[model samples]
Target: MARGRRLMARDGVRPSYDPAGPDQALRAALQDLRTGRWMAMRALLADTTQWWRWTQRTQILAAAAAGTDVVRAWLAEEPGNVHAAVMHARVLVERALRARRERHRRTHELWIEAWDAAQSATATAPRDPVPWVCLLALAQLDPEQRWEEHRAAAPEPMLPPGPWGLLAEAGRRDPDNREAHHRMLQFLYVRGGSGRLAEAAGYAQWAAGQAPPGAAAHLLPLYVRVERYRRDSGHDAALDLHWVGDEAAREARRGLHSWFENTQRAERSLSDLNHLAHALWGSLQFSDASRVFEAIGPYFTPPPWMYRTPDRERAVEIFVQARDRCRAAADG
Candidate 1:
């Protein structure tokens, strides 16, 4: 009878409690989480759980959400189960999300901790979408740094060519998933540094129609582009350089501007023009920059930018200087 019971215990799911070394902290974290005993989990990882350890550093945080303890004991018992690992990560992420909703002064701090835990889990398991999911969450909170990291470190190209691709596949698998939509939206309207604009444009079109109302804030610039591209037969640098497509190729095919008159009717976003102007200036496309300045000149009032806040403040000054330079060169 004792032998049979012991054998049965062997077959049952165990929690991660590996004591071999620090590298097995994520395993230990999963173990702690399964035990439903937070104290035990804390004991298992005591002294070993240090910040930037990245593995043990962020485990069993779901305790706040799950209202369980004994995360450490669970790990000591069951060390190698991938399903458990995923479950543990999900719990933490959900908890993090919840915390973000009812946040107070310490909200960003909790989010940071949760993000760290998620990233650590992702680093441990690269292929799983859960970590990517969590990292995507973190991107909202710290996108400038986080997206830069994802773009710099992603295993694939910043954006791939195939349909049902990274952002597309995420949208398809979870259509109602705000996360997938939000991430791809961010991918579409990237401001600066290492974004693949062509792929970003593809994501914009794929994301345009059914992406969700929450994407409205992001849609303004893309809408204006789809508009400008349609009306401006002469301004095709983006289309020509990347082979994005003709203006007729846009999903809605509605022009943003009227060729009969040079006025723009859409809601204006100054930050969009600021980024566009800088990008064009960098490429020596003064004509494109001039068009951008002319189109968005009506709304160039003060506002904040995600990356280039200061530079955006100086746009009128910069545009004035550029305009004078172009005028001088044209006559000379």
Candidate 2:
């Protein structure tokens, strides 16, 4: 069993966030769609839809994250394309989120536009969970009371009646949708007050238990942990790995053994691997941490690593050093 231990930084210089390079495939796909390769883009979306549903959803989200313009153009070219509609709604919701984060003056207007797009998508693809997921994400932007009033006033309540209703619809459409569950967890996190973080943790644990064996949903608790740490460590210069408790270590170990170690599909998500590596390193399982680092290779996600600092470059630097230290200890 791995005992809990702190992995300290070398050189005593903390790192900061710098924008990382774009994912080439996602970038290229967005470019292709934007630059008149409509047939190719359609084929690509079709191919993704034929893949594992989770992968399809993730890829759609990735494409949507690239930009709304390409997806909008696709929608205009093929007005009845369900994929285009869903992606367009997702992009609008993402833009709404960005506007909220940046404190843009027209944030509410963006949210309304997102809500409209999501509703249209839902109508176009009644069986698709992706549109419901977008609606749930959009609902999360406002307080429940505010959203309730908005929903009541809306011509058609863009989403299903309520947050739970939207979530249930998403689940009904696809029971194994991790993104849908994640959206609910975020909703709960946003709604809770002083005990919000703890509530989020409880929800995460429950969701993980409800998920199929070896599913990535087991990693949800780690996300909660990262969020909690980020909130508590506000403006702190360095993150003390010791902040991660024994229970979290045990849970991380269980998650690794049950969902990560034996599952071939776990390789699809570098973010999950990064979280696992961070947990294992903090728990003094250097050898296990080393293995995860080997899997991660050149890619890094800046969440739990940068929970202390918003700097992506600094996060990558610390991640590399920590991985190196773990590998050395494991090899010795």
What TM-score do all the candidates reach, one by one? 0.31, 0.79
**Poorly placed runs, candidate 2 (over 4 Å):** 1-27, 31-39, 50-68, 148-162, 192-195, 234-244, 265-267
lDDT of 2 at 61: 50
lDDT of 2 at 89: 79
- Measured with C-alpha atoms, the lDDT of residue 112 in candidate 1 is 70
**lDDT tens digits, residues 246-284, model 1?**
432232112122110232323223444444444344344
How far residue 276's Cα lies from its native spot in candidate 1, in Å, is 34
lDDT of 2 by residue, 1-332 (tens): 11112222332333322122133444455556656455555665676642234334434553445453666677798888877777777778888877877989999999999899989988898888888888888766764536553233311233222376677777788775667767766766666223366667776777787777777778888788778777767655545554356877877887688778766743346677789888888777888888877776666778778764567556766786778789898889
Q: How high is the CA lDDT of each candidate model?
A: 0.42, 0.67
User: Model 2 RMSD to the real structure?
Assistant: 7.2
- Among all windows of 10 consecutive residues in model 2, the one with the lowest summed lDDT is 1-10
